[model samples]
Target: MKQFKVIGVAALALLLSATMAFAIGAGVGRDGTIVGTKGKAKTVQELIDMYDSTGCIDCHEDAHDDWAASPHARSIYGTGRAAATMITAMKNGFMSWEYSGVKSTKDIKVEHWMGCMKCHLPQLADATDEVAVELADTLNEWYANAKKALKNPDDKKAIAIRDKHQKTLTSLNINCLVCHNRMAITHKWTDGYPQHDTVYGFNDGEHEDETFTKMKRSLIMDESIFCGQCHGMGPNLELENPTQCATAYGSYMWAYRAEGGQESCQECHMEKSGLGHKILSYSDETMQKMAIDFKVESYVSQWLDGSTLKPKAVVKVKMVNRSGHSIPDG
Candidate 1:
């Protein structure tokens, strides 16, 4: 994607940070394969392992590559900026007004931060009931496995055990099914454990699986409402007449709609301005180019200066808000 132009001499910078790296540890091998339970589980990590994205690439090779290069994959990876900020908070305590005075991660607990995880660390959001308990228990189990593996470094079983533990500690790799199957994925607490099921709605199209087709349409091809699920929520920071926090959708209804806008969010953000999956923000030079324009003009004085050239320079800046909601809303 190309960048929107700048008004003056400033060349747009395309130096945005790409992604943070997930700090790899014991248990998982060089191939990113986890030696963990392949089915239902008793802990949060176990549940997430059941839906890992490692295999999705085999079937969705192109999309997988596109997404791998996106900020979505990098966002929750241990190396991402958000991950670094959260890691700091996890270690140093809550640093915002929302969780004001919380002393540590243990003090407020991971489950209490559902609002953040629902977007950033969605696997944690997908797991059902007593999530904090599941997280705590899973962490302890992984630690134990790590210890066992360390004690017998050469043992194959020990290595597997260690890898299993490492899988739990690593943030859930951004899985494709989350966005595509958002309408279908269901998690419920059953018998004191969480169970996840995907029931897509299929249509009688050329494809046999109507639900899969519909899921793709709802998320990838047309709809913007799916993006709204997270982006439309409270805590929007772009409100012009500011309040504590408000939904971007509300502001869209108030201002953007009045401008006769009809395009979905994806039309601008994803399809036109981004790589297949590298959903960028306004700060990206490419994004800036798509949304703004500038023109410069100069005029010499009718009466020339006694000894020097005097001229008037005018710069015209045009910012076209094609989006239905305020940019930087999220």
Candidate 2:
């Protein structure tokens, strides 16, 4: 009876000590997360400056180099395909797609292409959802007015509006935190604009801010669902490509469900050479070699001239997929 009493007292004492330590904020490490006014960046330049100061490249130089070479790094900046293609088109007064029904760029809406900002522009994603909505409305109003005025080739107003929006589009870009930052938290105001509350969270287990929840939930952010938010959409989700480009997640669920969907998209697509951050696509030479088996087959066939072709003269190349999911997926 005395031993049991002593053990109970000791356990209670330890619990109290732990509670006191947390209460006093003692022995707890600081994560060094800084925030701008109201926890949000006011302008595009502010967001860019904050991203630069993170100094991720300083510590992870190899990873940075690998990432710089990747499509993700160039997705919105530094002559990336999306930005280069869209910016040139917008400048030339062309809009989104050149489909069978759509005759010219002028027929497409600017809002249609701007939706790319949701996935391709990390800084914009960091903003509050409300701010995104507000910006969309503002851009749409400008686009409608600009389109109406552009009916007259001599209208300077139309030219100015297109130029202004194009400048803004090019100025906005994706940043590293869009994918890696687990806790990209923002608050919504009663008035409907995004309010910054806190920055990315550290691993410390405290619920004082939203960062705790974000970090907790994002421990497995490498999963396919993470990529699905953008890649799961169909061709018409944004700029309307010729075919369905962003059906990775949906296809995985449909085809890979038998395996309990155990394999992650990253397992194959993102080959981790070192820091596990330099993500690669399936088209990468290394990935291609890893995922495909190429072979040659030959057979005799009758030619159009009615002559029999010798073996090896008529040859066919065969390629097999080792990938668990569909190839050429976004």
Candidate 3:
């Protein structure tokens, strides 16, 4: 009996075709081993590398690049660390919240409010720079974080962190910029001898590199107002701390190189228009004996009650933001 002849020829042909298709699907092709037919494989890790702690290199590639290792940057962050510790003492309670991830304005807006930008970001009295607006947005974002903390300050976990941060704030680590932006011109802002007429400029700029250092800050090194941008408060205050630097200057232990090796805030926080971030530094012991120093002193008199003539007293003070930032004053 011929078994192959039992089924119809057409049916046999269909069965053979179906068998061939199943065999093709089940087995591997010439590519060796068969994997999922996704796309080509990636070479780099999706997320692995971390940012380097080498100062503001990417943003400040020029003169400030030189300054990245200087004490100015150190003081800038140091002041912040000291401030955080002070806030911890205040016992706002929410302690564990970490702000170390904040690396830029975007980070500040999205993460936490730092004491430096709260004031040092700069607000021009007679000018409005879009850069300032970017800075303002960043600070406002910080305000948003603070407001969030304040609203629910009663939360046990949040309260602990808040109180801890509050302790740092109360320690007077942040100083003027922690509260103010405006400074009085007081008098002639002259450096050396050749007096030039005063010209107002914005506190902010977007120059990726080599900006005001070549033009402005190089010239205005003597004016207290420049230093005031971070330490003075009145109309320019962005945030208020009861422990104001204006009230007690020695708390940060500032040392000055500007006025004969004296310690003051301006000596280190000095910004040349083109120079990038200035990181100031300090210590508590050195700051204790340091007193408020002024470059110029003035007095006011109105003929001792007679309306004949008048004069007002003014003074200039120079300080190193902290120890070892020995860059001198005019």
Candidate 4:
């Protein structure tokens, strides 16, 4: 009976230790998340497959199509410019900085690329360091071949290399799962961590999807603060070397909200404009017209200088920013 008692006490102690460990692990709220469940991706393609939302098109065709047309779809390869800029930042910014630890593209890791990818492709966080090296090499290859193709327009090999890398980069983007699942909630403690088998939006019920079989309401989905998570204030200071991207959210708060403006980002960019998932800004013609009001006046006048009469043309222009933030926000 004494031996049985000792065994029971040992089992109880073991259970208590496991409970403490689980509590510590769950403190950050990543315990049951997709990344937590499936584990960090070992390669770029693994990362892509982990967050793929192509199945969403079966039920959400219109939203998918609209999103495909948006910059979010090709975030890392935005019209080829974003990809080039990332490479430029690596070569000029990282390699040039003595403390950056990046002697060349081969030295670049996930931490090094997160300065840009933090917003451009947040899911890169879920990828291993090897994936980051692969991405850097791919981007460098694409940029070199693209430049060569520009110089030698008829070079099929260069064109093919550029196109192939471009496709790979575009495959990773801010897709449906990114918004509705991964980044759906900011206050995890208050609302609970985003579940691995759940989709978050404006509903709470059984979801038809196999992987994500449940749906929950997101508290800030329609709020400007939601968009502000990525379209952030100046400089992500949390990184080893801070990178300043968009200050639109900061401007919106200080310039617009502080001065009695009442419109949310979704109200202007989504609802009233009717762009839906295509969420465009200054680049779209409709958004351009909606963003600002302009007035111009021209007149001819006579001026006298040193007893000589001369005709002068005068032009007057007035412009007002109608959007929530500045005209040229990042």
Top-TM-score candidate index: 4
How displaced is residue 304 in candidate 1, in Å? 11
Instruction: List, residue by residue over 183-270, the lDDT tens digit for candidate 1.
Output: 2222212211111222132332233332222221222224555566555656634422222332666666567666777776677777
Per-model TM-score versus the true fold: 0.55, 0.53, 0.26, 0.91
Better of 1 and 2 by lDDT: 2
lDDT scores in order: 0.49, 0.51, 0.33, 0.90
Q: How close is each model in CA RMSD to the real structure?
A: 20.0, 14.5, 23.1, 3.7
Instruction: Give model 4's TM-score versus the native structure.
Output: 0.91
Tens digit of per-residue lDDT, candidate 3, span 1-330: 355566677688899867755643433331111111211112111000011122234543664454444433333224345334323422232123353443333332211222333342221211223322343342233334556667876656655554444432222222222111122222223322111111123343333333112112233335444454444442323433222333122223243223455433444344322223333323222232332232555566545547556565666556533333332220
What are the per-residue Cα lDDT tens digits for candidate 2 across 1-330?
A: 999999999999999967755643422221223332324454545555554424555655776677666666555543434645444434443233344232433344333344454456545533443444444443554555456666876777777776665455444544445554422322212212112322232343433533223322243355666666666645543344433446767777777755665767777666432224556656467777776789998877554544755433678899987665667776
Model 4: pairs clashing at backbone N, Cα or C within 3 Å: none
Segments in model 4 whose C-alpha atoms lie over 4 Å from true places: 1-29
How many clashes show up in model 1? Answer: 16
Q: What's the true lDDT of residue 138 in model 2?
A: 37
- Please tell me which model should have the higher lDDT, number 3 or number 4: 4
lDDT of 1: 0.49
